[model samples]
Target: MLAPESTRALFTGHSLGGTLSPMLALTLAGLGALKGEGLVYITVGASPGNKGFANIFAQTFPTSTSTCPETGYAVWSKNIINSRDIIPQAWCMKRILSPAQNVKNIPSIYGVPTIPFIEFVVFWLNANANKSHIMYAPLPITSCWASSLRRPLKTWLSFWVSHWGITMHFITMCWV
Candidate 1:
C-alpha cells in the first residue's frame, strides 16, 4: 500500500520483467489501486505487445506535462531501449528482421566477421515466425546505443544528476 504522503509510484523492470511491468501498472490502475497520473513505469529491453494492447496502454496512461497533484514532478512513463539489444525487437516482424537485414551496415567493434548465410538463415527464421497480420507497436521510447555510451557517459551522468540527484558512481556501476 502507498503511504498518503507518497505522490508517485515508479515501476521498473528489465528483460522479461520489463515486459510485465507496464502490464502490471495498467492492471493496478484498472483495479483502482493506483491512479494513472500518479504512476510511472520504466522498462528496459521490453518485448512488444499486440497493437491493441499498446493502444489501450497509451490511452490509459498517456504521457503528460501536467504535474502530479501531491508532487510537482511530471506524470509520465518511459521505455528505455538499448539499440543494440535484440530482445526489445521481439514480436515485431520488421524489427525482428532488422538485425539480419542490416548486419553488414553495423560496424563490428570486435572484428567479428559477418557471414552472409547466417544472416539469411536468421532472416528466414524470424520472417517465418513473425507474421504480418499480427502487428505489434512499441510505446514511446528513449533509445541509446550501448556501444556509444562510454563516449556520452559524462553528459548522461550530468542529466541524471540534475534530474534524479543520482550519484555518478551509481550510474556508472549500473552501466558497467
Candidate 2:
C-alpha cells in the first residue's frame, strides 16, 4: 500500500515481521522516499536485533515516546507482546551456538586499517551477554490478557491446538 502513496507511509507485521516493518521504514527513510516524522510502524511479537543494528536504528530514528494518548510513539515504532506469549521474552546464545569463524574481527578496508566499530561492539556485547537475543519494548507491553495457570498437559495441548490449529508462528515455540 505504500508504493504509490505520496503521503508518509506506515507498515505492520507479526512475529518476525515485527522486526522487518521498522527495518523497511529505515530503508525507505534512508532512501529519502519516506518522511521520518510521517512514518510509523506497529509490530506484534517482534524479536530483537543486534546491538549494532539497534544503535544504528536508534540513531536513524528515535524510539517511540509516551505522553500521547495513542499507543503509538511520538517518534518511532511500537511493539506488542502477549502476556502468556514467550516469544518476545525468548533468550538465546549466538556465540555458543556459532562462534566466530577463523576470520579477522575487522578486515582491512583497502589497507587503510579501519576497525568496524559497530560490528566489533556488537560482537563484544554478544559474546559477553552470552549472545542472547536483544529486543526493545514499549511500556505496558501487554494488553488485557490476565494471568491464569493451566495444568501442564492442558497448557501443552492448548498451545499446540492454538498454534497449529490457528496457524500462529509457533515453530520457534515448538523448538522449546
Candidate 1: give the clashing pairs. none
Ten-residue stretch with the least lDDT total in model 2: 101-110
Model 2 residue 169 lDDT? 40
lDDT (10s digit) by residue, model 2, range 32-141? 77643544455444444544554556666555564664643333454554444534433223323212211122222112233355246335543544433443322123
Please give the CA lDDT of all the candidate structures: 0.53, 0.46
Q: Please, what is the TM-score per model?
A: 0.56, 0.49
TM-score of candidate 1 versus the correct structure, residues matched by position: 0.56
lDDT of 1 at 77: 62
Candidate 1 lDDT by residue in tens digits, 1-176: 64354446666676676678888887777777774244445556354566567677778777654455343233356566656543455445554433331223322311245435435644654555544355555665655555543333344335446755433453344343
Give the distance in Å from residue 133's predicted Cα in candidate 1 to where it truly belongs: 5.3
Best by TM-score: 1
